[model samples]
Structure formats: C-alpha cells, structure tokens
Target chain A: MSDKKKTGADILLDTIYKNGVDKMFGLPGGAIIPIMDAVKDHPIDFILTRHEQGASHMADGYARATGKPGVILITSGPGATNTLTGIMTAQMDSVPMVIISGQQATSNLGLDTFQEADISGMSYPIVKHSYLITDPKEIPKAINEAFFIASTGRPGPVILDIPKDVANAVIDEDYDDTIDLPGYLAKPELDIDKIKDAAQMISQAQKPIFLVGHGAIISGADKILKTIVEDMNIPITNSLLGKGCFPEEHPLNLGMPGMHGTAYANMALCECDLVVSIGSRWDDRIAASPKEFCAQAKKIHIDIDLVEINKVVKVDIGLVGDAKDVLEKLHKYLEPNDTSKWIKTVNKFRKDYPLKYKKEGKLRAQHVIEEMYNLAGSDVIYTTDVGQHQMWAAQFIKINSPRNWISSGGAGTMGFGFPSAIGAQMACPDRKVVTIVGDGSFQMTLSELSTAVVNKLPIKILLLNNRYLGMVRQWQNLFYENRLTGVDLEGNPDFLKLASAYGAKGFRIRRSSDVRKVLKEALQYNAGPCLIDAVVEQHDNVFPMVPSGANLDKMILGFPQKRKELE
Target chain B: MNNNIEKHSISLYVNNKPGVLIRTSLVFARRGYNIDSLVVSNDSNNPKFSRMNIEATGDTDTLHLMLAQLNRLVDVIHARDLSGEDILQKELSLVKLECPIEKRTELLQIAEAFSAKTIDLTENTITFQIAGSSEKLNRAETLLHGYKIKEIVRTGKVLMTRGEEATA
Candidate 1:
C-alpha cells in the first residue's frame, strides 16, 4: 500500500500472494535466482519439482482439484520449452494456471546469450495470454492481469516472462490492484430467449437426454444439473472430463458415451430424439464422426465459449453463456413430464449389455479398479494417465462428487497422473489421492517420485504392470492384422525397487486374491507416498469400442469380430 | 478431404506489440497453408492497434478452422473474411525488365498501355511501378513476362470496406 522503493521480484510475489496463491511448483535456475531469493522472504510455500513438465502438470492438477489458479515458476530456454506439453494439456482441458518464466537480461537478449529464448513468442499459441515485462514499474500490473485472464471465463494457462535485470531493478511506485484490459471479455450474459427455446424443444421431444460436460464442474452447476435431470425424468450421460459432475450411482445417470463408452450410453444417444449438451465441446472422441453422431436427435449445445458452438457439429439451438446461468433460466420455463417409457427402454439396454470382463485366471485391471472403488468409497480423489489404464479407471471407478476425478481428457498426455496426484494431495491434505498409471506411461515422468517424497505427500500410486502399450497393441490386433511393433516392454524396471530408491513404500500383487489386500495396505500406509504394482493381463482390450470413423451403433462388444468385414 | 484449393483473404485487427505479427502468422504456417501475400501497418487513428491483411490458399474446411483459431488468439480483437465482403483491394508492384537500346521504345509503349510509370531507368534496364487491383497487376506482369525480367518487388494487398461499417 505504501509507495516505497521495491524490487520487481518483490512486487511480483506480493501480487501473486494478494491473489490468493499460497503454493508454487517449479525449479530454480540461473536467470531466476533473484526471484528464488525473494521467495525466501515471502509466505508462499514453494514446492521444487524435479522437472519443469512435472511442475506444469502439478499446477494443472492443483487447479482442477481446488478450483483455484495454479502457479508455476521456471527459468529460461530449455526450462520454458520443457513446459510446452504440460501447458498444452492445461489449455486443452481448460485448467487455470499462471506460469512465470525467467529470461536473460534485456541487454543480453537477441545476442545468442546463455539460456535465452523467446518464451513469450513460443508460448503464444498454447497460452490464453502472455506478457513480456521489460520495465520494473510494469511488474505488478502484469502479474495481476495474468491471474485475471487465467482464472476468468473459459479458464486456461497464462504466461509472464521477466528478464533478469527487470527483476533486480528497483522502482518507487504503488501496486495497482485495478485491472484494465479492454480486449479481454470473460463471461457473457445469458440470452433468455435461447433458453426458452431449448426448454420448449425438450418438452416437445419424445425422448430427451442431458449430455453434461466439464463446464458444469467449472461453473459449479451440479445442483442445477441434478434438478433438471430429476424434474424432467431424463437420462443423463457425462463426457470423460465430466465424470464426477453427476453421481454415477444414480438411477437416472447413464455412463459416458462415444468410443470406449458403455453400450447403453451410446445406444441411448443414438436413439434419443433430443440431445441437450451443456458445457461440453463436441470433441472428436465424443462425437466420433460429427455428421452422423446423433443423426436422429435434435441437438442443443450450451457453452461459455462462443467459438465452440458450431465448430464441430451444427446444433439446432446454441446458447452462449455460463452453464449454470443457462440451466437456471431453462428450469424456470420447464414442466415436469413423464418419460417412463423412454427410461424403461434405456434401462433394458443397460441390463442386456452391461460392462463386463472375463474373471477366470490372471488379474485384470478392471477388477483392481472395482476393488479400489469399493474400498475407497466416495471420499477419494482419483487421477489417471493416458492409455488402457485411464479408460479402465473411467469405466469402473465410481466418483460421487465433482472435482474428484481428474485426467488429461482432451490432450491424453501419458505422464500426467503422478505429478497431478501430488498436486491434488497438496490441495486437499486430508483427502486420499490415488493415481493409476500403466507401465508404459509411468516411465515417462517417474522422476516426480522425489517431489512426493521430499514434500511427504501421501499419494498412492497404482501401476498396472501390463508390460505393453495396451491400447496401441489392441489397435494393432484389431486393425493392423495383429502385427505388433515396438509395443513390448520386455525389460521394464521393477517398480517396487524404483519406489524403494525414492524412500517410499512399495507393494506388488500377482493374483486376484491379493488385489484387495495390497490396495488396502497401500491406502492405509500414511507415512508417505506408496506405490502398488499390480501385474495384470497383457492382451485384454477395452470393450464396447466404436471403431474409428464408425457411428455409435457400430460398436465391437466384448471382442473382435470373427469375420474380416462388418456384419 | 476437400481437395479444391482456392485463395482466401482474411483481415485482422490486433494489438500492436513486438511479437504479435509472428504469433498471428504462425497460425497459418502451422496448418500448412502458404500465405501468398501479407500486409501489416499501424492504424492511423489508434496507434496502439494494427491492421493485417493476409492472402492464403486453402480448402474450405481447413480455412474455416483456421479462421476460428485466428479469432482465438489473445492479441486479435477482430477477424473477418474480407474476400466475400464488399471491399476494395489493391497491390503495388515495381518490375525491372532487361531493355536493350532497340527495345527501349517498345517497352515504354507497353508500360504506357498498362498505365505504369517509369520509376527507375538505366542504360539497359527500366523499373516500372504499377498500382492496381491484384488481377490488374497480374495481367501487367503477364504482359511483361515475354521480355527478360530482372527483378520484381511487390507490396501485398490492403483492403477497406466500401460503406461506413468499420472492419473492427
């Protein structure tokens, strides 16, 4: 509040602190030494990650878990580039993050100096916004604006690049708390007419389904969404990122739809007369082939971003506003209807072809996930890496609340689970955080085990040791005449021994009987992080998959077809 | 899988920053679309903003996706397809052709027919400057292509709407 001479680094830290950021994840480097030194004087808790990519994913996981903006700090050059994958992951999933990267001195820039790169230019496409601060006086305003842009509307990551000299320079100026961004528009008001039209369409349709997405969680519209589903007696399904928005145990809730989704959910989408999508972009995974995704349905799309309305599939009615606002308004104009016949049909479909797997010999990944769901109940936060393990977790794990299921849905990044679990654990110190990763995905960013050990984060790691890239192997088996290449991991390291090297607890289970016992032991081991490696079946493929370029009705259930052509 | 490629002219109004130009153009280059001509200049009324006109060749679906991506850029305030709008487009080009003593009179007559001005004249070369629509400039260049052309410099197209409805 006082106009005293302060260093730019101090102003930047003060601004972040004032914006309600208590923890930061990153590493220290040469150009960012001043900022690291200033961190000692501040009250923020800095978690030093082993790699910059790990730091970015940790921030993303923290944001998804707590509904707050995650902050990250890194040095110049390679440090900045290493965070690209993580930044793109956050941008794809709409997570809010503030990334501060240090740069070389202003005089040393453009001279091919040591560890100098155009961080702002490189990150422009991936970030929501970026700022390069050259003046000491502009430090506070830049930090404030970066946080505002990151956490508002369709939230995403933002970057602030500061030169070494700018951080060291002293300026006599007061911190400006007011944000003056003429170009940035966060939330748009709801159009009542569009909501009314959507309500009318839903009432007139014979069978209507509510397609919810991550936007519901972002807008905190779980209550309104539940009300709409219950009042109208409509069946509801969620996207991969929207797993926990609605309770999976509810009778009115169908599972996810599209590739790797349940047969009942995809059938319901194909048969419904109206598909009311809220806060979910019609991604390729969700819509498969957009032209024929729901040919029989009259679609209504609601989202906060105006550009995503008709980008994929054209909708009959498009409402550009917050999910909560639009749902609340639509509820006012809707009336209770009897959808008993439609619900009965959907129930029959669900009962006829339920999600099942063979349970005879070796341990299956689905069985382990089901056991974890039963033991952990509804109070745990779960994260998963890409590939077969992620799909298994999504299909079997039961999430009872919003913000409890976190994954890299859109980008499908492999090394996202472990560091993200650490972040989620940090955000909710009392809740149990479990990360399920496959053998191939776990090795990508295994160095983050040190971060958990150093911070004493009690995150449980579930490694599905299948010894192969399970998803790609399945694709090769089905589409490429079973000629697998480079999918085997024959000489993989022992995960239990790896955990021991990081000074943590490790366990292994090779039989179905030992699954529950080992999982219980890992969850109860509260001293530090625990790694439970479960050796599961190798050639098992996810069921009820709609092949590429196929419609929802053309699903391969249980196993591959007997003939070479379609039936 | 639409293979019919056609030229597209897109205009954007963006914040005038040091790296905004590269950021704006990268969107096109990443999509594998070749930008034939790109013109950028600061807005006279508002010095803080700049207007950019880019001409690229792409298919219909890819161009639509590119426009959506361009509008999502942080520095861009507004983007529009000026090719379909009622607008005026012009390009300026300076062409240097090899001219011998016997062919100097013939080259001057050709330049006079196309309303080109002789900007630079040497003993064996003449640089004629022409300003007109893109089609007109292409026609003039085609007429001078038979002669041995030494060099050519072109200022890309700039466009403005006909009525008072501002592009931004």
Candidate 2:
C-alpha cells in the first residue's frame, strides 16, 4: 500500500473488490476509456454486453439470482441514459445493483462536451443514491458507500458519475473500510411490542392468510416462514416477485394474488379474517383498489422500510424492522391453532377455481411452461419477459427453491428475459437457467443472443411463438371490442435460424403433444444455449383477472369451463 | 386534498455539499408536494451540515413517508416536520409598498398595529420589515394589500426546538 500510487479507476475497482464483487456487465465508450484501460489489472471479469441496456439487465438478473450487488460500467450520455429502463426495473423490484457512468472531464462539464450528460440528475428518482466523484480522492469512499447502500435495507440501484479527469487522477493516500452513513438505517431494531401484537392477532383469528413478498427472500426468512405457516395452519399467497419465497407445490400455499392472480388466492384474501403481509409493501398490482383490497380483513404489515408502512393501504399493525428479525420474535409467541374449517373452505375454493385452459385445443404458453417444468423440474431457474408469457410462466411454472424465479414484476420491462437468463446462468454455472419469453418481447433485445454465445452461457430460451402481443390483443378482444391496434408481430424473424446464427441449437414444436419431447431435448442440450420456439394458441388470455379499478371479487373467470358435454 | 391538507414546516439538517440542496428539494417535488417557500443557511453548530427550512402544502397521509425519503438521501443527516409542535418558528419579510404623502399616516398606524419596523423610506416607496410566524406575516401583508405592493423578499421559517430538546 505504501509503495505504489493508485489512480481513481484503480481505487474504484479495488474498493469494489474488497466489497466482494468479482464480475461486472457493460460496454465501452469514449468517456470511460481510462477505467476500461485499468480493468486489465483487476480480477473482475468485465462481461461486455451487446447493449448498455442488456448489461444493466444482466447485472440485475445476477443480483436477483445470487442476493449480491451486481456491478455495471459504461460511458456517459447515451450510455448512461440507455440503462434507465434496467435501472428502473431493478429499482421497482428492489434488486441490488451499482452502476458507474463515466462523465466528461470536469473542465468540460455543463459545457455540453462530447458524451456529457447529467446522469446523477436523470437517475435521482430511480437510484437509491448517487455520487458525482469529480475529485479523485472520493473514489474509494464513494465506491464503498455505493455498494453498502445498494445492498442494505430495501436494496436498489446506485450510480457513480465519475468524470474522465477524476478517473485519470492519481493519489497515494490509504483507504480504510469504514462506512459512515449517518441517516441510512440498514437494520432497524425490532419493535417487540408490535410483533407480539401481530402474534396475538394471528392466534385469535380463525381465518388467516399470509402474503409474502420479495423481502422474504431478501431477508432469508423462507425456512422460518415455512415453519410459522405449518404451525399456525394458515393459508398463504405471494406477490409476483415473491413467487419462489414459498414453494408453489405446498398445499397451504394459495398462489399469487392480484390482477392475473389465482382465483382462490384472491378469494381467500377477500374472505380472510386476518391478513399478514410479511416484508411486502402492497403495490398497486397487489392492491389495485387499495380501499377495498381486503375490506373485511384485519391487515398487519411487517417490513424493514418504515416508509412503506401505510403508504398504499392502512394496516392494523405495522411492524417496522427486518423481516427475519421480526418473524423470529413473532414465532416464539405463536401458539398452535385449529383452523380446519377455514383451511377446508379455502381448499374448496382452490378446487372449484382451479387454473385451466382448453386442454384438447391448440398448444398454449401455459402448456409449454408446464412441460418445461416437467422436464426441467424444480431445480432449474426460470426467467420471463413481460406481457402474456410472463403471467403464463408465473401461473404455470412452480419453482420449489427461493431465488429460482426472476422477472420484472413492477416495471414489466419486456426485454429483460434473455439477458437476465444469461446473467443467472453465469452466476450459477452448475444450475440450469431457462427463459420463457414471447415473440414480441423476445425481439425487443434479440441482439443479446450474441452476448450469450460469446460468453458461452448455457441458458435455454422457450419462445412462446404466438404471432401477436397477446395481452394487449386480449384486452382489445374483451374491453375494446376486438379493434386490435399495433399488436401484430407478423414481421418477426425465424427464431430457430436466429439461434443458429448466434451459434446455438434451436428446436420447434407445433402440436401440444410435442411440447414434452421438444422441451426434454432442449433441457438436455448442456453443451451450449438452446432455443425452443413453441407455437402457442395466439388468442389465449390469462384468466382470473381483476381489471383496473375493480375489486378482487370482480374477477372475470374464463369461459366457465363449458359444463362437460353429457356422454 | 383532505382535512389535514395544509401547510407544513419542514426542517432538514444535511451536509453542506454541492448537491445536497437539490437532492433535498427533489424529494418534495417527486412526492407532488407544492413548496410555498424555501430557505437554506450554513449556520448549523456542525460545520459539516447545513440547515434547510421549507414551507410546503400537502396532506399528512404520506408526509411521514416523504420525511423518511428525505432522510434516506445521502447528504441528509436528519429531517423533521416541526409543524403542530410548540416550536419557535420565525421568518423575516421585507415588504416594499407605495407610500405617497397622503398615505404615510395610515401606513404608520397600520405598521404600528402589526409591529412592523420601517426598514427603508424612499420618496415613493416605504419598506417595512416584519418578523414572526407565517400566519402573522400573511395577515400583515393583507393589511397593506390596498397599497401597490412593489416587491417582497421573505426568508422562510427558521425552527428552533422551543424548550430544551435539541433541534438537530
């Protein structure tokens, strides 16, 4: 430390390395050449992505899969602006990510020099925090603080806008590893009285339901949550981001609740006497009409972020602290309860409202997902893009492990699937990672296929080749009186040839019966990436949908499974 | 707007750095709270921090959440809404109004009742200095509304914890 002089770029890499980051995703540009040149000396693998947006999404995917902060490096102006969608996706879902965008030299700032942009200003609303390191000496502290802020509390994206001059400047001072954030409270002390209050409410309620969210996985409360649910005999539901927190195969789990959520889950939420939301802020999707989301239930919210409490809907008890800490405390006070009647009622609702499709008709996205699950099993990680395919994957695929289901829940970014799967595969090389995407969404960032091929990432792609933007078309079909506008994808290129162009294997299936055989072959191709273009029914719409401004009880259950034709 | 939708006096103690003030105000702007007035000064006991006072109007429904968001900023050390508390809040306003020879007597009488001091006197304009709560200042301005008001500069509220609890 005493013998060598270190430049700001070196210090940035050094500090991030000390914080346990080994890989980053980004593209090179003029303003970032100084840092790009310094990367050769560092141990971090710079996974150069095809587009800056892809880099950001890949990093987000990596972070979500591993529960660690993903790092990104790119240039200023267009480079920084391109990552906005990815950053907002991470921000909405609370994934941990750090981004470094190079700026013009300090002398050229505000003068609109080449590649100059106000990144910090542009990203203020989305980023958890940001640092403008015009001074070289601030590199270490800013890097360390960015990592700390992005990985703690309600994790999100943070950015560092470093000018080229600062990145080139050298310093000889030593950097110590002490974080001094006076106001950012990462771990709030447990409020025992509130936990006891929630526990007492749980004990007295005959009909109780749990709605766990992404925070449950973030806090590693899966095992404790499972134990609590089993002992209390409570039915449970999850948010889209909370898909893997509770095993979907468990009998007590009632699946997701919201606009396209399972009918039984929404009905249980409507009928429950007590609803405990563990580490979840009831977003608009979960409580679209907040006033009537659970008008009949006593709501208790347990979350680490104090701001999220009472933000969307008022709760009877708001416990502010880490989910794991509060759950452990509440577990001790919980007593066994007899909820046989309540359980039986919810089970009946589940049976009567089972999710279905025209089983004997054309191939559907849900069938492809189920066949993929049958072939890949619960061990493989599945990522999905936005729109119909995403909801279909969520409704059909049942992942048994936490951190195995990743998607853009809040932001609904369409091009998030392929790049994120590449990231997940890179992060977990031994495990299988597959992307269930639609034709419209897949073409949004098909350029990333080269990224996977160049990196030799063995990720699989299950393209639901439905020739239209199915979700929007469905809305037009139902609400807009069939006047579909700009929803067609007739110009999409041949996906199998597209995969072959990128040096990967591709397969196609036209019949529902071929789904299993094709998926088995695609899942077994371990040498490189595989793409399965499953031609699904074009007009199928997700059911049990609570339309905007409608309550959970107003679900439009699909064409009431035509009372079976008499023999 | 609801019954609680009224003006709120918020005080923030933050690092006296280049970008802290913008970050502080961004929170209000993003939350859709209208800022009526804002004042920033670097007279805090701690040199590393600056004091900011903002008079904004919004319902109390998400006010606490707004404060939490402000406190989450990197440069903000602490933030509080001192409204509805027995706190000593003061602001200074210099109001320059038309003062013709015929209106001088009436202006003097009105200034005396409001306890406003004459800060400047020109041939055509008289400027009065008023210091007190925002409500008092508003009332004083209403009395001089008949006169042609030329210009006014106000230092938004400065809050001090009334008894012994430290403001910071």
Residues B1-168, candidate 1: write the lDDT tens digits. 466688888999988888788777888888777889999999999999999999998887677777877777768887888767678888999999999889999999989988999999999999999999989999999999989899999999998888878875
TM-score of chain B of each: 0.95, 0.93
* Alpha-carbon shift of residue A393 in model 2 (angstroms): 0.7
**Candidate 2 per-residue lDDT over residues B3-103, each given as its tens digit:** 47877888888888777877888888887777888888896466777888888888886677788888777688889988888888888899999999889
iRMS, candidate 2, in Å: value is 1.5
Query: What is candidate 2's lDDT per residue for A69-116, written digit by digit as tens?
Result: 989999999999999999999998999999999999999989988889
Off by over 4 Å in 2: A1-4, A560-567, B1-3
lDDT of 1: 0.89
Kindly report the fnat of each predicted structure, to 2 decimals. Answer: 0.30, 0.63
Model 1: per-residue Cα lDDT at residue A565: 51
User: What are the models' TM-scores?
Assistant: 0.95, 0.97
In terms of TM-score, which candidate is strongest? 2
- How many clashes show up per model? 0, 0
Q: What DockQ does candidate 2 have relative to the true complex? A: 0.68
